[model samples]
Target: MDPQTDSQAADGGRVLIDHAHEGHFGARLRAAREARGYTIEACGQALRLPVRLIRQLEAGEYGGIDYQVYLSGYLTKYGRHVGVDEEAIQAELARLAPRQRQPDLVVTGGVSHSRYLLERYVTAATYVVLTAIIVVPMVWLGVRGTLDRDMPRLAPLDASPVAQQDAPATSSTSAAAVASATQPQAATPAETRPEDQQPVLASMAMFPPLDHSAARTPLATSAAAPAAAATGQGGHELTLNLPSASWVEVTDATGQRLEYGILPAGTQKSYHSDSTLDVRIGNAGGAQATLDGQAVQLDGFRRANVARFRVDIRDGKAAPVSY
Candidate 1:
């Protein structure tokens, strides 16, 4: 850099002496010290300089302070306290200061402005990755929610009288039918059935007769076989007619029990019955039945006429139920 042209303009061409000339920064420093009535030693004490060095600086000698930075600091402090034109002096110093450019050296040492740019890019990429990590699962959950809304519901295992009774067969047959229906085949045009297509068989089938009353085989004591057990012998029989929104329970001497329910008018498969060794029914009403020749008690929370009955069996016949 060259000497400051601006200082020339500001100070009306009476530029402070440069430190390199015979009477430069030292002469100006000496003039400031003398004006303040500071001897060389007094100037050294004020600015923390050695008397010999201060004399050397006053003579405009070089190489006293190895670093120009220390000279600048010393000049700034002395100039400020002495009420010099600090700005003009600083401008002159800036013009005279050594250049600090190292752009080529930075590149040669395997570090460059490009490295700073790449680090910024990597930071941006990391932020994008973190945002993706946070968002993907939430998006997945949203899509899953939408899918669930559109999907058909699975029937519960204990849904109804018919559903509970046919649960295993229904599942197996449905799986087989699904498999068969999906088999690869030629497309066939829709065809009209004959006007006199034979009537399809009803799904109902006869319950195989029980050979012995005490038999515990599944075929003998299934939900379908309960009616047959009542028909044959050796078990108590009770009839309960439950009103809508009601339930019924029946317990035998052996602690074996059964429960039944009736739901609202529009609900499908609303009736339920299950066999249990002990039974209690709640949240139902309006029931009636005979129990060992006495009336069973009735209790309820909603609509009435629900029945609870216990049976007594002797010689394989239903005894009158009792409460």
Candidate 2:
């Protein structure tokens, strides 16, 4: 092929020609550098670029440069320094660089697929089944336990035939004693005999007649008594007053639990016991106590905000005993 000359504007607006046989940009750049009698090192020094970078640029090896913009800038500087046209350098760079193809976009509605919906339904069903497996037996056991706890137990019946046969005889003897007690003048002359009177007296002593009139007296007396007197069978009474939330437990000497659990603010409660009473107060600073209507100071007995003491009946009076 005949040597081709590519003419391009250079530095100082001068025109230059590449006399290389091959019309490639790298060969033309090398030819231009030779025409200007400039070595790669001298050209790099003049353009403030590395010698290796100038060689790569002249050889059209642009892979060492990261971005196209940087490569374009370096090429423009190097070409202008060596009397090569910037437009020609840019055109050569565009031809050598790989083209970037934009991906095609497919638009769709924002609805979920049937398979995804089915998967979600299956997951929900699995969760429900798992929950039922865990919760159903627990609920059944709780209900069964509640039924067992609430169900009343019946007392065993007396099935002995001798006891059943004797019940009527005992009732008849009681009726006879009641009749004799109601009418003392209904005795016959034979019953008035000393020997006969003794058996009747023994029977009356064995089966006492039920007096319905005297039964009302005890009920009337209990109703007339104070409410405290009814619950406090033991002569001693203990009163507790709470100004704030606290826990109190009271037990009598008989090991009977009189009061227990958390008491709300402004709560007043009383307990009665015949013997010594055990008392425990949680949050002692908030509680006030009285034994037999006498104030019992809880502050001295308090330790770690808890007060534990005992109320003892001494000399017919209630007094606090602390530990």
Deviation from native of the Cα of residue 225 in model 2, angstroms: 30
What root-mean-square deviation over C-alphas does model 1 reach? 15.1
lDDT of 2 by residue, 208-309 (tens): 233534532332333223223224566777888877545566777778866544444456777867788888876677689888788998988887677889
For this target, which candidate reaches the highest TM-score against the unseen true structure? 2
TM-scores for all candidates?
Answer: 0.31, 0.33
- Candidate 1: lDDT over CA atoms? 0.45
- Judge candidate 1 at residue 76 and give its lDDT: 73
User: What TM-score does model 1 achieve against the real structure?
Assistant: 0.31
RMSD for each of the candidates: 15.1, 19.1
lDDT of 1 by residue, 1-323 (tens): 33456555677975554444435665777787778877877667877877787677567564557767766776677665555677656864664465223345443456689999999999999999999999999999999887755543321111134233343444565767576457635212111221122221111112223342232233212322223223112233344433332222344344544333222211222112222122233333344434334444544222122223334345654433334
Per-residue lDDT of 34 in model 2: 98
What is the clash count for each candidate, in the order shown? 18, 0
Candidate 1 Cα misplacement greater than 4 A, ranges: 1-20, 24-45, 48-56, 59-221, 228-323
What are the Cα lDDT values of the candidates? 0.45, 0.62
